[model samples]
Target: MRIGLDIGGTKIDAVAVAPTGQTVDRVRVPTGFGAEQVVANTLQVIDALRGRTGTTPTAVGIGIPGLIDHETGWVRHAVNLGLSEVALGPLVAEHVGLPVQVENDVNVAALGAAQAMHLDGAHAYLNIGTGLAAGIVVDRRLWRGARGNAGEVGHIPVLADGPPCVCGQRGCLETVASGSALAAAWPGHPGTTATEVFDSADAGDPAATAVRDRFVAGVASAVRILVVTVDVDSVVIGGGLAALGERLLLPLRADFDEAARSSPFVASLGLSSRVLLAPLDQPLAALGAAHLAPESAVTTA
Candidate 1:
């Protein structure tokens, strides 16, 4: 068995997966603030899964939200988790006595989503959740850029005068498109979550509808940016807002279709067909993490 963990902004998801990709056991715990609590909470979840499985995992893989030095397994920064320069892989390896491989969460999720969809060649995983970002795969391999921040498209400037981003920039796409942005901009209610905004829009609230429309447009723009830039096979949408299902995809599809009808260049790209929603039930990031370490790293322990 192998242990896979996805350390997300809100929750840390861990799973024990058999060789056949079947889940042996899974556990989730709320993500803790600060580096120490995050590591402690992650270990607690791992131990719980190990107890349930009654065996030490052959290898362990972790997906964290930040710029990870893949060679050292040190996280340069994970803003949402309040972590910086934390040696997460070494810490987890010492605690579990297992070989550990840590990667950026979205990059691992890209692999997971590709595996789940049985995709090959090139694909882009567009995650519009707590923040907006993407993970790219080329020829079945992760295209981590020179700085291991290849897919940090969230900070891409979409508006000249957009809201501020934690990355010390204004007009970032995340400022307008992310779940955090949606919650902050909800017209009908204060502290309304992205999911709640979708709910209210579904109920025909005009104010909520306006926000939803703009959000969808922003999402469409993200899709266009990915396709025009990379021309990947498909752009798979995953993350917290993905739970809204067709409520999200349908509008996005309509927008793309309209764009295609207006511009032959858009139609020629067939961008709408390439945009897809990720499966709801799949724990892709964790599953991808399970396969991250090579076979040589698996220990008898």
Candidate 2:
């Protein structure tokens, strides 16, 4: 068995995956800063899950947000968690006494989504949740580009004079199209999540509807770039926002179709039905990490 920990801004998801591709048991705890406390929470979850599985985990994997250098076990910046230049993987390994690998959470989720598939072809995973990002899976391996910053698709600057991004860029895809933007425009709702905004738009709230339409354009534009760049067969959507289903998807599909309809470069791409909703609601990182543990690294004694 293997252990996977997905640390996010709001929650920490831990799971124990058996060898046969099953999530046998799961645990979750709210997330916080105080880096030491965050690591402690993960250890506690792992300790609690250790008993039932009957074997020491072959490996441990953690998924965190922000820019990470997986090779050096360094997290250059993780703003939501208030960490900068933290040696995250080594610290967690010290506490847990296991081989641990740390990676950008969205990338892990992408791997997990890909892992859930048949694995005979290339695919992409797009997560639009509290934020927007992607993970690329080609030929059954993650395309971690040079410097491990391959999938910073959210900051890819789709607009020239767009709104300001947390990354300090203007007109970035995440600024105008993500859950944060929808929540900013409509603040008083019961559920300020992305789903609620779409629900409000579905119910005819003008402000919500405006953001919804803009969001579709933005998402379709982003997906088009991904399709053209990566040439993947399909893109899977996961995370909190995806719970809204076709209420969000239909419009996105329409936009992608409209955008790709006339491009000769994208003509033979066959991307009309390329976008797909993830079968699993939880983000993919933790599971992908756990699944990767033993095989990704080998010991020499």
Candidate 3:
């Protein structure tokens, strides 16, 4: 059996998958902030998942939400978690009495999305949650890029003088398109979440509607970047805003269509139809983690 864990900002999800690609057990627990608590919570979930199956996991994979060094097995930086540098692989392996593989959560989710959806040829998984990023898969193989930061599109500048990003840059895609950005831009109600912003737009609130429109444009821009740069066979959309479902897709599709109609170059790319929704039936990152072991069938390479 192989075990996979997705350590996110709000929750820790775990799953055990048999050699046949069937999940035998799964568990979820609230994520603890900071390094020590996060590790403890992750270990707890692993133990619980193992206990449910009454079998030892042959390999374990963990998806972390930050900058990770594949060679050093250390998390270089996790801005949201306030984690600077930590040896997550060694610590988890020591506690679990087994070897562990660690990778960025979005990258693993891309792997999971590709496997679950059985995408062919080149594919990209766009994660528009608290931040914006993408994971690329070429010919069913993951392309992590040099330094394992291949898909850091959130920092890509889109607007010349838009909002500021945590990375100390102005007009980054993350500042305009991510869930965090939506919440930050919401002017109708204080502490309103991204989902509520979508809801407010549905209710016909002008301010909320404007924010929603801007968000849609930003997201459409992100999609265009992937379509033009990599021209993947498919682009899978996932992450927190996914819960908005059709409300999100409608505007995104509209924006893409508008762009295509105006520019023959855009229409030839066929970017609108290439965009797809990621499967939400399972925790993608965790499932991708299950396939992370070097010897596992779902290899990232």
Q: How accurate locally, in lDDT, is each candidate?
A: 0.84, 0.75, 0.83
Model 2 spans with C-alpha error above 4 angstroms: 187-193, 205-207, 260-267, 293-301
Cα lDDT, model 1, residue 33: 91
At residue 260, what lDDT does model 3 achieve?
85
Sort by lDDT, best first.
1, 3, 2
Instruction: Name the runs in model 1 displaced over 4 angstroms.
Output: 54-56, 187-191, 199-206, 293-301
Tens digits of per-residue lDDT, candidate 2, 1-301, equal 8888888887788888887878888888877785776767777778877876667877788888888777656788888887788877777677667777777887788778877765547777878876788887776567887766665678888889987888899888887667786676567653555766677788999987887898877777667778777777888876667776787688987766665577765656655688888876554787877755354432221
lDDT of 1 by residue, 106-129 (tens): 888998888788889889899988
Candidate 3 lDDT, 1-301, residue by residue in tens:
9899898888888999998888888898988788888878888998898888999988788888888875556788886666778888777777777768888899889888977888879888999887899998876567888766777788998889877898899999999888888878874554447778888888999988999999988888888888788778888889978777788888888888888899999889887788888988988999888777454222222
* TM-score per candidate, chains pooled: 0.87, 0.87, 0.89
lDDT of residue 286 for candidate 2: 79
Best candidate per lDDT, number?
1
Residue 235 CA error for candidate 3 (Å)?
Answer: 1.3
Candidate 2 global CA lDDT score:
0.75
- Model 3, residue 140: distance off in Å is 4.0
Ranking by TM-score: 3, 2, 1
Residue 207 accuracy (lDDT) in model 2: 81
Estimate the overall C-alpha local distance difference test score of candidate 1.
0.84
